[model samples]
Target: MATPEKTGDVAVHDEIQPAPLTTTNTIPDEYRELDNGEITAEALGGMVDDLPKGYYRSMSFIGTMLALCLGQSSCYFGFVMPANVLTIINEDIGPNPNYVWIALIWNLTQAVAFVLVGRLSDLLGRRWFFVGGQSIGLLGSIIACTAHNVPVLIVGSAFIGIGAGVQLSFGMVVGELIPNKHRGFGISCIFVSALPLTVFGPVVIRSMILHMGAGWRWSYYFNVMLLTVVVALFYFCYHPPTYAMLHARRANHVSPWKMVDFVGVLLFTAGLLVLLLGISWGGSMYPWKSGMVIGFIVGGAAILILLVLWEIYGAGDYPLIPIHLFKNRQYMGTILTAAVGSMVYYSLLVLWPVQITMLYDTDSMAIGWKSCIVAGASLLGQGACGVLVRVLGKHKLQLMVSVSLLTAFTGAMAATTPETPGMAVAFIFLASTFLGYVENVALTIGPFCLDASDLGLALGLLGATRSTLATTAQAIFTTILSNKLVTNIPKYVVPAVLDAGLPQSSVTDLLTALAAGNMTGVPGITPGITAAATEGNKQAYSHSFQIVYLAAVAFGVCGVLAATNAPNSESKFTNVVQRKLHHTGFDNKTTKEAEA
Candidate 1:
């Protein structure tokens, strides 16, 4: 037996070690009742009812929840809200060809920063990163609200994206502080707490755009106020066992900063940005065979290959991603599921509003209400999945079922027509519902399979990988929509207008006017011809959108297969809390605290 060295109030091993095993024995003692040999496993099966003192029912826990909810709201406002109102923003700022950059930049920056934020927070601490993220988010809101150009909005989005990475990485915080059996429910509660924003955010933004003089800029202003309060709340209320972990690392003579995989981080960030840039350009900014497009895509793929080699051989003990993570079947399956799920979820988030405006309704308020269907359905699905996971204890089964349902509904969306707005909305609602459930199962599957020390990094990898894949998928879908519209609009609209007795010379004028949403300037345009042109435009958009949904269906099928491979998590769920919340008065004073 060896003596553990003392550092401040914590204990440490003399040498750096691999991640700890995720077993009941590894959970902090205060979270587990004394082994009196009389407590039944049935007693341990309850969710929140079994949560230890410092977690669910305490005031400190309430504070923690409030902080998490506010931060979650900021992430939603910074990315999701802006994404919905991008068209409005473009109208106000005057459209830029690079307006797509506003959304792409956010996803790119978040994916790039996700790796470092997770690793550093694990080594240094979680509190300041959380607070700093909100502060950055506030700055981004300020930048966006004042911006008069697309470039400035893109800049603001980049800053906000980094802040979003912090929130995504730290999502594991809730799982760690609660009973293992309740991880799904616990995480769901945080999301459900932000239900107001998820459901009504789009509608509110749309109303502002239509009714207020400031238009879309008001969304950013609201975020400024929200994030300002969140920054202060997190700074004061969100304290974990970070100081103890830092002290122990210091005692072991391990430099947290030195241990960082800077080279690995840079390689990953650059590789993803280059890859995404290449994807964004193909069929839009540049031709597929053009030197800029091919060069970026191939060069980025090569950099990623180099990164894999560096992680395996070049980085001694401090690889950015633990090599073992790649070997863990459960971990690999979890992240894979996460990536595919995000692809489906964000596809709807980004494209559904466009679909509404193009095919169903052009009014701002109508578009806003239509968009709310997805969010409302998704929240219900999240709550259901969380409750079911707690009761059934079959994570793999839940994942398989959810992903399959999502696939079926998404594939159904490909059948949409200009005349079937009702059916299209139904398909979106069902797809979004299952998409939410799939996300919960994927996130819950992680903690049960990995070590506490690895959890933060693992979560980071999940967020980064999912963000990257989803962003790539989005770029592909956008390209498909753009290319299809180029062909389909003229294919459908030109014929109908010509057949309706419009002169040959007026054909071009009609198209340009229709594209600009104003038929006032077109020659030879009449009420009957205007109606014909409108129908043709809707048909073209419907067909183009159908292609996007089919692509989403392909991704969804892959997710279903991945879900089938997820590890059984029944045994992993228990009364044991992996990490206990400290600095909270509800913790048992008599028990010695556990060190990370």
Candidate 2:
């Protein structure tokens, strides 16, 4: 086996280095565990990339890959399934204005957990974390499926969000296990696993809502089952190599927990929570000008500032966020692009369904299939980009072209009208396709630039930054869209309905029914008045949605600038495996036992 050189207590590699040549004659015995679960680094064997090309074709490796893919699919479910069925859920559970929490809390928990989870997984092994995360998601599914109120549902969403956060951290695990050159393909495999669901998940959810009484809850039941299988798969299939440094630290009586930056964790978690809370509350639960909103925003900003200062000066050797990563142009550019791109996508993900429900069709099935086009298009884009990157290997150009095209397409969406629904669909599909390309570059590029030891921290920071920024952007977009709808409805719909011979006394009821997409019992309502009111409602939603798309276009311009800062690191791709899976008897081991 090739021996790894060490620096102090940690094993550090600044760049990808080819493993030393070894022959079967020089190979060591199969890794045997000590009674305490620790195995020496020498016994752990050589890098998997150094093995023969077809060495990874074994069933064990395939099972491991399947588990990773399934883990990613569960995260996708947590994000996509809930948002699509939220309105139906609210209808069954009463018209609670706070129903937005079902989505917000999911995002908020992830934004708060990414940094801590990433660093901890780096210190601790990843297997249990992956399994435990899915288990939590299963528990969350149970809770959400059984919820009778919005608050209960929000609590369930929070658990699922936390689980998704850890599942996202598995990106680091995927990077470490795959050869560096094949990272794009490896990462994309997990993403592509969600493609089937992205394309058809909405159809299934809508069908359930329409056909079965309380069938929306059945979606959560399916989630529970999927997560159960994911947890078991990860537990049985993922058997990662035991690192020597962990054993070294254990022998010296060092504690992994001691290395944690508790203060930084507190500051970051609290700050993100407060900031997102303030943003979510603004113009929804409270006015933007409310003292409560301003106070929370300002306080969160202050705490975050303190976190930066602490991470730089106060946290000793092991800061929660590695300070040096900020200096790498490629890493920073990737993070910025990913965050901004997600913000742009959020404009479509959150608002497009609302646009469909208000203007195009209220039938659950139609709304489901129609609103899912962008997601399906994005999946195709992601798959195409994955293959293209593997073949072409020019990420900078891909990012540049994708962001440029995405900007043009997103800006065009502002021209959507009730008469031009086809135009909106076309532009959004084009925008989403390019957005997927941008996402592909952002998700895979960071590993190329950073060292192997910092993989967990880097991936974690990327996920957290993207989640926080996107959540904040969603709030801003919703506020702008809501404010515009409030203004435009009164200006356009009120006049059109009144002119159609609708009585002034019944105007409020008529407007409410139009917004709700049900005109069952509005006084003085006639077919002519309904026709005029429908047209006006469509016009109001079109105008409001246009403003939201215009706002996303502004962010797209920023994404273009961020993409420029990214380097073309085609040379960094190589057949270097940072950490190889041991594939031994890890299924029965506890974390402390494994490290001992």
Off by over 4 Å in 1: 1-59, 243-252, 586-588, 591-596
C-alpha TM-score for every candidate:
0.88, 0.88
Runs of candidate 2 with Cα error greater than 4 angstroms are 1-49, 52-55, 243-251, 503-509, 516-523, 584-596
Estimate every model's Cα lDDT from 0 to 1.
Answer: 0.76, 0.76
List model 1 lDDT by residue over 174-291, tens digit each.
Answer: 7666767777888788778879888988988877777888887887888889888878777777766563444334534655666678888889888888987887688777887899
| Predicted candidate 2 versus true structure: per-residue lDDT over 1-596, tens digit per residue | 34544645654332323223343333222112222223334223334534444336645567777877776777656668768878777988968998988988898987766777777666666666777877887888789889999999899999998888877776787777776667777777777887767777788777777687877787777788888887887788776644333444353444666677899989989998998898878888889899999999899999999999998999987788877888988888888888887887776788888888787787777888887887887877778876787678677777878988988998898898888878878888898888877887777787566755567788888888888788778888999998998999988889998999999999889878877778769998899999888888888889988888888878888888888888786765655555555554333333344445
TM-score of 2: 0.88
Clashing pairs in 2: none
Which ten residues in a row are the worst by lDDT in model 2? 28-37
RMSD of each: 5.6, 6.3
